[model samples]
Target: MRRLMSNNLILSLFSLKMFEIFGCIWRYIAFVSNQNTFLLLTILKNDFITKNFNYKISIKT
Candidate 1:
């Protein structure tokens, strides 16, 4: 019947919207994790460089 078809249409639309929202959330999480990893790597690299520089200076003195 007409009422049944309309109900089905509304249900499908609602499901589609929910799916889109979840997809966006997933992508955001992935992006944030990647950014955090990059930051951690940068900090570790700088620390290593600084330590090496200090060690060399100490050796020279």
Candidate 2:
């Protein structure tokens, strides 16, 4: 009975540790995804502004 209880306690602790690791990994992934999205948006905005500038010049010419 003592051995069984000890095994159960160890298993519970292991599971808890694994959950913590998974949570950390998930947070990291979310952060990277957000950063990537921000970068993509900045690039798109720059492209749009550049295009508008070109169009205005062409019209003036």
Candidate 3:
């Protein structure tokens, strides 16, 4: 029937919109996690450098 076909069309459109929204959210989460990991790596590197510098100073003294 025509009505059944129209209903199916609407449902497909709705599902497509939902899929698009989910894709955007997934990409955003991935981007934020990557930024967090980069920040953590930088913090660790700085800590290591400071510790090494302190160790060298103590050895010299």
Candidate 4:
């Protein structure tokens, strides 16, 4: 039971991460066609935030 529970938890976490990645990719694609400086800046900001998030996760692990 414990093993199953852990597996399910891991699966859920993985799915959430996948969803976030897809969302970011979709946003980036949308931004690509925008051709606006502000939108590009916003995408860059998101990239910075993603880098920070990865750093925090690594530190926690």
Candidate 5:
């Protein structure tokens, strides 16, 4: 479970970075067409936060 959580954290961070890069590259599209990039970014941010929070909680216990 701990290893799985750590892997999830890594995947989340990797995905977040990818989205951030894509966000930078397609910022104009995001501004003009849709807010998908930001939405995905926020989702990833929440995922990372939750995973990190769980990791901390497990460590404490």
Candidate 6:
């Protein structure tokens, strides 16, 4: 009975460690995706600004 309890304890500990590692990986993926989205937004914003500037210059000319 003691051996069974010890085995269960070890298994639980292992599962807990796995859960923590998976959590860290999930957080990292979320952070990276957020950064990618931010970059895409900035690129789109820059393109829009350039387009507007060009249009204004063309109208002036």
lDDT of 6 by residue, 1-61 (tens): 7886686667657756765665566566657788776566556655755765675466446
Candidate 5's residue-wise lDDT over 24-60, tens digit each?
A: 6556555766677767766766676677668657755
**Clashing pairs for predicted structure model 2, backbone only:** none
Candidate 5: the clashing residue pairs are none
Q: Write the per-residue lDDT of candidate 1 for residues 1-61, one digit (tens) a residue.
A: 7886686667657756755665566566657788776566556655755765675466446
| Residue-pair clashes per candidate | 0, 0, 0, 0, 0, 0
Compared with the true structure, all predictions reach lDDT values of 0.63, 0.63, 0.63, 0.68, 0.68, 0.63
Q: Comparing 2 and 3 by TM-score, which wins? A: 3
TM-score of each: 0.51, 0.51, 0.52, 0.51, 0.45, 0.52
Candidate 2, 1-61: lDDT as tens digits:
7886686667657756765665566566657788776566556655755765675466446
Evaluated at residue 24, the lDDT of candidate 1 is 69
lDDT of 1: 0.63
lDDT of 3 at 58: 63
Candidate 4: worst-modelled 10 consecutive residues by lDDT = 52-61
Candidate 3 residue runs with Cα over 4 Å from true position? 34-61
Candidate 1, poorest ten consecutive residues by summed lDDT = 52-61
TM-score, candidate number 4: 0.51
TM-score of candidate 5 against the unseen true structure: 0.45
TM-score of 3: 0.52
lDDT (Cα) of model 2: 0.63
State the displacement of the C-alpha of residue 33, model 2, in Å, after optimal TM-score superposition: 1.6
In candidate 3, position 11 carries an lDDT of: 60
